[model samples]
Target: MGIKGLTKLIGDNAPRAINTNEIHSLFGRKIAIDASMCIYQLLVAVRVGADNLTNDEGEVTSHLNGLFYRTIRLLEIGIKPVYVFDGAPPTMKSGELTKRAEAKKAAEEAAKKAREEGDLEMAEKFSRRVNRVTPAMIDSCKRLVRAMGVPAVEAPCEAEAQCAELVKNGDLFATASEDMDSLTFGTSRLIRYLWAGTASTASKKGIKPTEFALDVVLQDLDLTLPQFIDLCILCGCDYVDGIKGVGVVKALNLIRKHGDLQKVVDTLKKEKSYTVPDPYPVEVLRQMFVEPIVTPAKDVVLKWKRPDVNAIKKLMIEENQFDSAKIENGIKRLLAAKQKTSQVRVDSFFKRATAPNEAERAAKRKAVAETNKKSKKSKTQKSSTSTKGRAAKAKKDVT
Candidate 1:
């Protein structure tokens, strides 16, 4: 869906460049998340043996469940998340959408065939790929997020583009999405594998989320941001076809030598097998990547408030038939975390208020040491004077 083979390209070419850390390491950070991506991931990952979360009316609720719990987990760990939703798709994305629909159809057929053959493993694998986020699912997710007091944004175009814009404007610390396209969208930092840590079982023990800083990636690739986008395009972007016989490594090398996309196109034109597009809208794609429509910074309001537990219970437990015990337990955890964070802030405030400044404390200690030294000197001098007088009186008695 992003630049095809882009993640692999970074792994192979610039190994040891991206940052990797535990999920909790993002504490106290404000992250702009691509909600659509998260929803798709949750829908795919939450299934158990072809069974997903559904309510009384047989409506799928996996997206809501994932969003609710995931947001709670983020809050418990002190992460402030702003969920950005996708609005209308850009005209260029129409082709990508069609391709995805066809792929999902093929996956569905493959899953059916696998099920008929009694190959459960293969069927499950195919089924995961076929899962899609629906409009109803989006609405449910938004409702859940609102009840939890997190910001939910409707982006003008791609959610990742808006996230990138927020990060660039300093409204967010980074963008969270699995798609490597966030990098091309000019996000200063991108987070991946956020859902990888949901399980603590032995099989999922080694999986952890990773962070990628754009500056480090660019430094490792020896290219500017624009050049990196061009490299991604050459590797293959969703908007256009790439030249035949050109791959990621080859693209990087060409970009390194040519310095720009136009130069790279001119060089590739001379090749016998490589055929550049006639009306290559590579420029247009670049423009979209660099600057996309997004909500202005002035309009964005991010404030964390107390979770509406009654509303959450009514929606998830009463209406949707989610386990009441689980919801209540989660609510308790949210309350506990809120109190704990508040207590921490109060403790920190008093500690700072009562604690003396290092410089003043040092000066007081120095003065006390000097006074002790002067008193000790006076005692020794008095003792010597008394001893001399006693000796003088004894000499006079001997005379």
Candidate 2:
């Protein structure tokens, strides 16, 4: 279930719902973060009461501020975060993208018309809004993240799926995302309420927030990982959008009875007499869920580098016109956490270095570099071969 549904079900009692003590027991664990998801939350939250946040030179500072603060919080919690950014979205998501573009275009036009009609206030309000995710903006965020010592993964398509795969393979403990879709996507651990403790909330005795554990979900559904994927398809997901009239409850029941999707489909056709036009081409969804790209060399590390306090103060207090005190406090908290984490990492590194000899270390380094070189060469060769094949096919078509 998504956050909306889960929140509704638990209400104020949500916090008491999950064993946070046990969850924190898994602290210092590596988390594969859906970077775009966190970015979206930052954008929306920061822009809630304003159209745009401008820096001293009148540049947009909303995205930057959001990225800066949230990243600090994640690091403060002692969680090693591997940020995964979206690349070109998969082909099936084109329709959703097109709809988003149209909506943005319509809003822009309305804003323009409001300005022409002398409705300055409305025009200004609409003009300050933004939702489109651009390649350039994503690149800028990636650069900032890298400079901060956060390792980033460039996912070919769905970042959440790749993150989920990382967790499944035990490379990561969990995938951190606000979107509950990660559960359906096959992540073993999906922790919601990541920002729970730091933020304010109304007290409701006996109510607890919950982190929907995958094992519990799987046991409840009585389905294996692949079977759960089948169930999600029934419940409607990005690949299928959804089946008409089939919701979470009904989808669960359908899957439980049929044992698998094909049988479920056959039963629907025969018993219900419903012609289910292939919900989505199964092959496409399979390709979409292909194994994530994993780095063979785990040299990549996440460390908390100290924030440039003067730079942050200038950006937040002077430029953005935020309260100086709040900005200072936030920076102080961030710096303290950074110092602690850095010391731990440094100590661990030196300890490991002391254990290995110079010759052994050199040999290990050489082997890794050669392996990476071979991988790159093979990828280039494959790309060249594919291009030649396409050219040959075009020539034959011309004939």
- Top-lDDT structure, candidate number: 1
All candidates' lDDT scores? 0.80, 0.62
lDDT of 2 by residue, 43-139 (tens): 5556635355656666555666677666666667665668888766666777666766787788788888988999987886766554555565577
TM-score of 1: 0.81
Give the CA lDDT, 0 to 100, for residue 288 in model 1: 75
**lDDT agreement of model 1 with the native:** 0.80
Scanning candidate 1 in windows of ten residues, the lowest lDDT window is 346-355
Clashes of each: 0, 10
lDDT of 1 by residue, 227-310 (tens): 888888888777887777888878888898888887888877887778887767767878877777777766778776788888
Tell me how far candidate 2 lies from the true structure as C-alpha RMSD in angstroms: 20.1
Clashing residue pairs found in predicted model 2: 13-207, 13-208, 14-208, 14-209, 15-208, 15-209, 16-207, 16-208, 16-209, 17-208
Cα lDDT for residue 183, candidate 1:
93
The residue pairs in collision within model 1 are none
